[model samples]
Target: IDMLHWMSRAALEMIGRSGLGYSFDSLDEGGKPHPYSVAIKQYLPTVSEFHFCREYVLPKLRQFLPPRVCRLALDFIPYKKLHKLRDVVDVMHQTSIEIFEAKKKAFEEGDRAVRAQLEEGKDIMSILIKANSEAAEGDRLSDEEVIAQVPFRTFTFAGTDTTSNALSRILLLLSTRPKVQDRLRAEIAEAISTYGEDMTYDELVSLPFLDAVCRETLRLYPPASLSSRVARRDVSVPLSTPIKGIDGRKMDSILVPEGTKVYVSILNANRDSTLWGPDSYEWKPERWLSPPPQVLTDARIPGVYSNLMTFFGGGRACIGFKFSQLEMKVVLSTLISQFRFSLSKEIEWKMTGVATPWVKGSSVPKLPLTVELLEAV
Candidate 1:
């Protein structure tokens, strides 16, 4: 089975429900996909066609042109891929507006109306809308700002692909290592026996093997392998250890000029031999099962999670890191408890914002795995 395809659908459904109190996918095999899902699936690949524009042209344009002027200019530009991207953005934006309007109307209609929605008005967007309604007038978000919060577009696009890809990587790793999979399954089974099949958030996240497996997969193969940041001001970043410069002098720090665009290599940082020891490249969940080595701790990796750069760090750290972790753990716990996954085909991971698995020589993203149902643990 191609796990990537199904995982993408599942990820969309998850974010749709939890983030927007909506559903973009039923997740039934061969079911008709939601329009939003269709648009979003096309979004990343289509945008990638214009990587030069997104990385360079757009940035320069934004500095000189108003957003409205730039948006208007797209209509005059006769690029097919650009037009396709515009159409995709339109679909996502329109959907966001519709969802926002519905939620706003429900909020204005009183508690009974709010209680009648799909999520019973408890999803993140609903909670935000409620809070916005009750906040002081000066603190209220504008309609446009609230609409932008709709997961149909921004949240779904940001959270779905990265998460699904990460989950795919974890499953792929487990498939190649049966003993590790069995051990994780046993740990989950024990947890289920103690906490019931439906474990609480605290109980679920507190699982040692499950957490280790996730952290290990994320460390070895971060979905978003690179992150870019512009220095807000000239700053000196201290290195964990001094490095020999071209002059043969030790340099413990580097001065980042103001406004310099820095591309942080998350993959390299996570797998650095110096910081994580020589075996850093290996996938060993047991590493996280114990306290991290002193060198790693003292390295003070700037990432927001587990001293790894998978989620970036500081103020711009991924807002969905916790949510993504919870989602992965829940999916892993449920799937591993009832199914067995084994490698079925040769696959390669390609980096395109998110790392995606593909059958060797195939252009499409896919991960074929042998999955077996477990009658009983």
Candidate 2:
């Protein structure tokens, strides 16, 4: 049950350091939580509760309401969720501003140490700030826009929650399916025997079984279930099989008009019986070992990762797909090599912001696993 929280905290630390140059001290050095960490942790679930606002209302509000007016309304609102969200946003904005100011100061004062950190594209936030300033006049963002862009550096929700939830799913599956877990560990053990446990990026990525496991996991349990898209213009979508309409007419394609909302079902697509054959709904890592069927490949279902809708498709696809995959692979390899996990109790998975798995009736996210030390594969 506790592993979920530990995994979430570990993910928070990983993204905090990788996405930006900040440390949440979430792993090991724990005490009273970092104020930002507390705020950010509470943020997603709160925002998820108000999804209607985010999807349908907030965009409109932002379009219509000025910043001053928005702030005034926030100040006057007595709602609990709104208050929590506002506090989280305040923390994010303040922390980003501080980071931005510190970087600005270091650059202005010509601190060689800070300058060295900025060199060779080591720090993403610094690079972005520098690039924004050096860009052409037309390409340059306004000061307000540039400042506002700081929140995206760490990418608070997506970077932490997305990877964490995906990882949680992977761990839960491994715990329940011991044979599959053993096979994965055996594969890692062989690699460790040759590479001495310090597997390079190339070696980690090259492991076929490991790759298959990740692909299967992501395919079965995507981070996001439904991704909504708004059609920019009237368009027709090609379908592999014709469907009879309500009017009793067979339709091969459906017309999508401009401004129409299209909700892409990532879960259904990944588990589609037609595309992936009868075993599509089953969690079989070996399925990926074979070459993809022509029928599946020929359909040209657009996606960013593994031809699966787990990461969605096209230009707006997940940017951190590789990073998330690497994190999962690394974490799994390290953990499975040392510990064996078995289910402690039944878990109920809820389809929410991150589709968390928790013990029944428990408010907190949890997956109880009886972990034991593994002497060898």
Candidate 3:
């Protein structure tokens, strides 16, 4: 919990510093809550209201009304409530505007001296601002549009928790599997020693064992269990091998008609014994060391990962794949180098079917590993 909190705070501070030249100081120096976080927190109530409307109110209303009537009722629901929701959204917009104006004014007032003193002006938001200023009017995002992205403040919350949870799981596994952990530690140590104090992107990307560890873990237990998509047209997805259907007929394809809602079972596909080998259920990174067998490597499989649909594939795949991978590697290396991790208690991880797995009970483990601080050579 502490690690996750710190990571979230750190990611937020880093994103703020790098993206907008603003510092929340949520991690390093213990900075106070910035307007961004404040604005984001304000939207939580509104989101809850939306959830309440969808889950409780709407369903209850539907019990006595026909489907079409329910639809009309929802449409007829007072615009006043929506307008109120818009007002809450406006707070976020206003806050973003304040941040942008402050930044713009700083840049305009020959405040390059201040920027230089900070040594942190080249962040994502700064770059975006620069681009926005330079671009043609039609190409640029309006202040309102830019402000609407205030919810992105929650990215830190989402990214940090998910990634840290994944890292923690990997550490737990490593601690139990001493041999595997030793191999990984040795691989990382060799890389660092070979590269000296400075590890370049190319060097980091080339760490095969580390990469395999991450891939294998994600394959066995993806943070996200399911993903949904709406079909654009009637489509047929071909199967690698025919399966006997209820009619006792060999079925090679499944027909998905237009507008059909599809939920792809990512976890199921990743661990499918048919796609993977006999030891598919096992967590073996070495399996990824060689080219996957012909059956698994078929192009028809939609996996952003190694013949597994952990990150999905094709046009809708995550754009942050490279970024996430780099972050994971960096964090794992740093932590492993600092201390040894071990399991606090014998427990099974509960699947939440969300982006990250949560322990079954409220009493989630704090990764009570014995942190044996490494000695300097």
Candidate 4:
């Protein structure tokens, strides 16, 4: 089975219902990809092609020209990839507007109309709409702003690819380690036997070995390897220890000028041998079973979760990280308890903004794994 393909579809379906009270795919085998899904898949790659324009040309134009005028200029540029990006944005923007209008109409119609929608009006956008309607006029978001939130599209674009890639990575790892897979399966089976299959949030999160596996996977292979931020003010960032400067003088802090673009390397921080010891390069989920090395704790990496820089940190940290974890844990527990996954074909991972698995020699992302249905435990 091609794990990445199915994982992508599953991520879309999961976010569709929970984020927008909508459904993107039925997830049926051999089903066609949804139009929105195809566009979203194209979005990142298409945008990457315009990095030069975005970083230099667009910023320069924005200083003097209005957004609409800049858009018009882009339309006249006659670039193929630029046109493709415009189409992708159009689809996402239109879809978000449609969903927002439907949600607003439902909110005005009463509770019955709200309850008629999928998720029974419990999805993220539904709650946001309801709250916005009841808020003070000054606190309410404009229609354009609300639509721009694009809760569904944002989650699909941000969460889908990353979560699916992480899931694919974990499955690939599990496929190669039968003993580890069986141990994880056994842990999940025991939890289900004790708590029933419909495990609560607490029950799911409290599973030790399962948590270790996830934390380990994320620590070793963060979906997004880098995050960027612009310094808002001039400040000196203190180093953990003084290092010799280029002038042969000890430097305890480095001055960052305002507006300087800073790139934080999430992957390097997570797998640092100095902090995590020599085994940092190894994939050992068991390392998380106990307290991490004191050096790691003392280093004080400012990650949003579990002392790892996978989610970044501070004001711009990933907002949907907890949801992503719950989604993974739920999927892993259910799937691991019922099926066995083993390696099928050789695979290689490529960095395309996110680390994506592709079968060796193939241009497309694919992770072929042998899946077997397990008899009742």
Best-fitting candidate, measured by lDDT?
Answer: 1
Candidate 4: pairs in clash? none
Cα deviation of 343 in candidate 3 (Å)?
1.1
Give the top-scoring candidate (TM-score). 4
Model 2 CA deviation exceeding 4 Å by range:
29-33, 133-139, 142-156
* Model 4: CA > 4 A from native: 109-111, 115-120
lDDT of 1: 0.87
lDDT per residue, candidate 3, 218-244, as tens digits? 889776778778799999988777899
lDDT digits (tens) for residues 8-36 of candidate 4 = 88888888888888888988887887877
Candidate lDDT scores, in order, read 0.87, 0.79, 0.66, 0.86
Q: TM-score order of candidates, best first?
A: 4, 1, 2, 3
TM-score of each: 0.93, 0.91, 0.75, 0.94
Candidate 1, residues 297-360, lDDT tens digits: the string is: 9888888999999999998788889999999999999999999999999999877667889899
- Please report the TM-score between candidate 2 and the true structure: 0.91
Report the C-alpha displacement of residue 118, candidate 3, in angstroms. 12
Q: What TM value does model 1 have?
A: 0.93
- Considering only N, C-alpha and C atoms within 3 Å, which residue pairs clash in candidate 3? 18-123, 18-124, 19-124, 19-125, 25-31, 223-355
Worst 10 residues of 3 by lDDT: 149-158
lDDT of 3: 0.66
